[model samples]
Target: MGVVVSLEDSKNRQASVKPLVDLTKGDMERVNQLILSKAGSDVQMIPEVANHLISSGGKRLRPMLTLASAAMFGYAGDSHIKLATSVEFMHTATLLHDDVVDESDLRRGKSTARTIWGNQASVLVGDFLLGQAFRMMVDVGSLDALDVLSTAASVIAEGEVLQLSVAKNMETTEDDYLQVIRAKTAALFAAAAEVGPIIAGASRAERNALKSYGMNLGLAFQLVDDVLDYGGSAAELGKNVGDDFREGKITLPVILSYRRGTPDERQFWRTAIEGGENGDENLEKALALITRYNGLGDTIARAQHYGTIARDALAPMPASALKSALLEVIDFCIERLN
Candidate 1:
């Protein structure tokens, strides 16, 4: 069984996200329109597969970061909408590719694009989305923003490749895992937050601050996700529990448990993980071992560490509703582990 959060903690998480959602509602409506407009193609399969995932109930958090970050600096222009749309496209594109790579059946509790449309269609449509995202970035006409997002795209690719290299390898280090998440996940987040301030014409200091905030928050978000794989319900995760373990993906909890465990436990990890012998019985064992070795708790601790850094990143900025919401987002990310 996965770790369950208390009702109070769950409510707190909802409260943190609700404000950000409310604040960005109007901008997100515009972004949703742009996403729909840009996702269209004459090719029937392209739109079919693209919309399958795009219209799925993702919170659109990355793009919301773009909108809210710009709103924080009092941006009144339409470019933030374009940039936010681009961010969503980029995120959606990555999900398509990730589903194919992970061979996942479900995403957000719906059939994965690759599962419905086949891997080739999913990959091709993902490429189309990336092209559209780049075009929108060009339309935004800010070289700095373009450079940041474009670099993030490249880094995300590199992160996926790195994850491939480390997959099913029990020898993978915590540093190696962090590098993968930083590139694969945090890079886009940093770009999303940074572009908002960039388009708003905020100071370099402010831009860097949001970037730091996003980066650390991304790290914390991913760490909690790792913990959730062992501790959260399917409803909460939108995928099966122990999905990471079943996939043999080396996450922080697995890394910590594998390292801290006894020699016999290490061998057990090798058998289940590297040996690809994961079954329900083995998954139960894996969860027990994780708990015995304090893997989940320690991973949450690490997330909290990053969450603190994320909070401090915003300290110099003046207080506002947006800033408070952003800070609460950090707390929500960590509190999911409860």
Candidate 2:
């Protein structure tokens, strides 16, 4: 496998989403309007909670992917707009539900909806958005799109359950963790990219290519998130650092550190992660150990592995502005470490 290119090796590697953003700007505006329209309701609190996350300055990358994938095929219709909006709603609902599950106090560097409106309100509003997303899918009149999205919803839930099962369990293996992230994170990305070509009536090979690209991109994205949780700041990650450790969630860093540490270091991790000794002091200790083991660096290397696959997934497609933008996005996902 090709290793991640160092920043020094990749000069002029503009690893930002600007090209894709610029290409999909007009469609994304419509998607945003639809998102606001669908998130509205007679119940005031529903919009309040929904809008909290919606307006929280997220990159809106998922919906943009839908738009880009469709436009790449020269799709000139309004259906992509609704589908893109539906994709955004699905993503927003997941965030609301995740905050409640993780008991997260913040999202996108702002207070989470659950913290302000309570977990019940957050979960209910998430459900409301999900219902609206399906309604939009139904409006599209494409059973294929519906099947892809609905199956993704089910798989995401299963991923969450699997993660919960492994929480605080030091025995979690690398393959086990990969399975959790694949379902929880990658499934939506795969669906979002696939449905675009599905609605555009693209060939099966074209659709499968985008799906594979999205799945590996999602894996790399989540692995970078794992690295950032320990090494990044609240502004960078949009959440408190060490939050995962406090929650006893066994991420890649913890798994690596635990597996490679001496017995005494392993015992310390057990005390910190399992025995609920995850205070600020322990968080400091955990950081030291993670650095000592180069866990953060190695996790980035793993993300690079998936990123390479994502790039290769695009190889069969003809080179174009859209293809170039999509390929650069893979670099952006991993090179965030730089």
Candidate 3:
């Protein structure tokens, strides 16, 4: 393990965004087109829901990672695009289902599928997308690809279940939180990055390096996201600032702040975490306590620690523009806050 770096250690810069942009040139347009084209059906309802969500516009970070990983290994084939599209479909399906499960009102600054199409339609369509993604994998014709993606899908479901199980449980430890994140957030990222090497026929060591890079990067990304839920404005994050607390979802910073709170402060957390009375009031108190205890700073340090690990994973690969872009991706994970 390395000493974690604080947010105050460096100012945010544009250099961090360079790598992701470089590796994912034209990916947004291509990904959306692929998603819409593949979601084709005679039934208008499936296409309508699929097109709505697919075109809603996310950062396309998952597919970018797949392409970036392949580029890093000097892979020149077009097959990475198919694989990347498959990964994006899987990720989108998860989000659609997640909003339904979480009863969320907003996602990516717009109405969620569940909100528009109803939970039944959203859930079934999500399942359809999952099967569509697998159909893509079959087209790619690689058992290695299938193995990594299939395992990742299983882990993602498990992670969702783990988080649901721990909800409203104030006794949840940091280790338990990390486990959920590894499964829910990082699993898809790791699979997306690793699929490149499998498709490119890279050696095991190279494959592992890409996997590590994605895992660490994904962890850093999600840790920052959790922090932003409390620290960022709704406009900046494009979602409710206190939505996590309101939903009784205990994240790392809130859990850490609670652990370090006085008896009275702990009582406040117990109410908030357990969905007791004065929910909004308790959210305010919890936010204030987190700030008082430097929970935000601690959270940033943890994200930076994983960002460093993501960078380390790139060391064994041959130097290229893709390599530089990979480093930038780690920095982007940290810099996005600013």
Among these predicted structures, which one has the highest lDDT?
A: 1
lDDT of 3 by residue, 1-338 (tens): 11122344445455466557655787546766787788888877888887778877667888988887776667787778788889998998999899988999888788887888899988888898899999988888989999999999999999999999998898999999999999999999999999988888899999999999999999999998888888877754667887888888888988889899899888888877785543666667777888888777788889989999989998888878878877887877765744
> What's model 3's overall lDDT?
0.83
The digit string of per-residue lDDT tens for model 2 on 175-231 reads 999999999999999998889899999999999999999999999999989988888
Model 3 alpha-carbon drift over 4 Å, by segment: 1-12, 15-18, 26-29
lDDT of each: 0.90, 0.88, 0.83
Candidate order by TM-score, highest to lowest? Answer: 1, 2, 3
Residue pairs clashing, model 3: 19-325
Q: Model 2 segments beyond 4 Å from truth?
A: 1-9
TM-score of each: 0.97, 0.96, 0.94
Positional deviation of residue 121's Cα in model 1 after best superposition, in angstroms:
0.6
Give lDDT: candidate 2, residue 33.
88
Report model 1's TM-score to 2 decimal places: 0.97
The better candidate by lDDT, 1 or 3, is 1
Candidate 1 ranges beyond 4 A from true positions: 5-15
Q: Of the pair 1 and 2, which is ahead by lDDT?
A: 1
